[model samples]
Target: MATKSLKAKGNELAESNKQLDILNGGIFAEGELPFFKDKINEIGHFPLRPKKLEILQINVGYMCNQVCEHCHVDAGPDRKEIMTRETMAQCIEIIRNTGAHTLDLTGGAPEMNPDFRWFVEEAAKAGIKDFIVRSNLTIIRANKKYYDLPDFFKKHNVHVISSMPHYTRGKTDKQRGDGVFDKSIKALQELNARGYGMPDSSLRLDLVYNPSGAYLPGDQMALEADFKKALKEDFDIQFHNLFAITNLPIARFLDYLIASENYEDYMYSLVEAYNPAAVENVMCTNTISISWDGWIYDCDFNQMLDLKVASKVKHIKDYNEDLLNDRNIIISQHCYGCTAGAGSSCQGTVA
Candidate 1:
């Protein structure tokens, strides 16, 4: 088991190295790929800007338990970047001042943050309308100490959004790690026992799905049906909703695309499937992504690419709602990923 795990880690490192090469090689340079602005302009919406700051997506850290093949964050257990209490305090202040309805907490595993529970407890006290935790599922069952997470989540009413690559163990384990499938199942059952996803229960649990390869995800409703049926019959698990997310071309997935000779094809696919309508409701329009160190970006993908918001005020300490409200979004060819097909965001399809 250790040998297989080591081999997987080696492969992950190799892909990450390849992705760094491609990113450093100027994959975002003009003419290297289709300009996102051109496509939007052709449709008569040239420069995209923020609509309203409805969701503040805070990336608390990059320390994770597993290294998935398609992770855009390139996060793992080895990552040292974790959000400090000072920075999180600044974020909470912004949330209070801005009255942002939803606090979307994300990370390598947001729960893995040493101060995660404290943050949640305080944030709830601040009266934020909704608390969304983007979990990896397996983390809850990763250790004996984490076993109480379900009850903890219930106590705080934290809406759990987990990533389940596929309903089947084979595809899921392939994309995630070797034994991830079994762990995820146990974790889901635990969540179910806690009234999460139960009919008429206020505690909501949603699962997110992203294609394991370069292709876009299938229809959200259809895929959700399949996931619901399979999980219920096979494991007797219950969940509220399934969100189908399109994999953006970046990080390990970018490396996979280039290594498999699918880089250009995948980029073009995003550009080709551009939905003009999807642009109006893209998550970036209402969401602001904050890195662990407090720098701001239009979305999580932009954060990974080191693309800050176009506004002069770029950090949480200097967060200016007036400046950010009307500021033009910083975008590139990668923007196509969010606008393609049914559209993709942390919430799921836009159009």
Candidate 2:
């Protein structure tokens, strides 16, 4: 992924009014933290831009059953940013015409969306190479209506990427909620029963591991190995892979850092662990994030920050892949969260 070196100019990237407001406030401006753009600039990657646009990650809504403390979207039951079928219709059009190979559906719990199944059924017809549904796991056990989610996912050949904060109950429940571990375990077992994570099965079941506190994740392969061994040993659970995602400081997570007085320390860690190599394959370079309403962003974090795409095509209704791809990727202090250490992405470490 060779990149064109951006000219060092004030108008390069951080000049966007909204991005400046976001980056200049908070600890980034108050403290002497290294700006993420400056770090990337050291490697001549200023004014980051998109590449092939491989993934279209859509946040169906923020109506989640469980309110994880580290949720960047601040998603919860009381939130009312649910996507209507009208916007979904616009998304369906993009799904059919997108050059992106992966169509990722995320939410508080995507299944909670009233028309979730209809959307999935329609999306499946597009024959996308990879259709990802980021489930909270417990949603399968949240209610009887969601009981058939595993079978529903299997029918659409949807890739199941569920979050399992940890293999242990204490850690998992602490980050999520009480009884979450039991329900998630049951959901995983149900998925396994349907051959979702069986070795060599086309049905893929992967678990995402987010550190329960204010810290970065360790080695991906090491974590995956540990999670696999523990889950299999304890409950005979089988999963294909584990994604160790670093918790970015934003939204509920930012609130946690501030409340715990770990904001500055966490920012320092992110800056210290910065990896320029990871910038080459940062998810933002190849993916576009569409919010619940239809606003597009460089990535989901950017969406949460209300940083719309720095392009003419800023919404799904007016999505123009060519024009969108031509725009510079938005950058700010939070970007360091994605570039720290091995580099975190929705698919785990990029480096």
* Best model number under TM-score: 2
Per-residue accuracy of model 2 over 1-351 as CA lDDT, tens digit each: 001111121223213344346456776676677678778888989989788989999999988888787887767776678888989888999999999999999987889999899899998997689999999999999999999999999999999999998999999888898899999999999999999998999999998999988899999999999998999999999999899999987766766677689977988898999998999999999999999999999999888777898999988878889999999988878888899999999999999
lDDT of 1 by residue, 249-310 (tens): 77767767777898878887887888999998999999999999999999998888778888
Worst 10 residues of 2 by lDDT: 1-10
The local distance difference test score of model 2 is 0.86
Q: What is the TM-score of each candidate against the true structure?
A: 0.92, 0.93
Off by over 4 Å in 2: 1-23
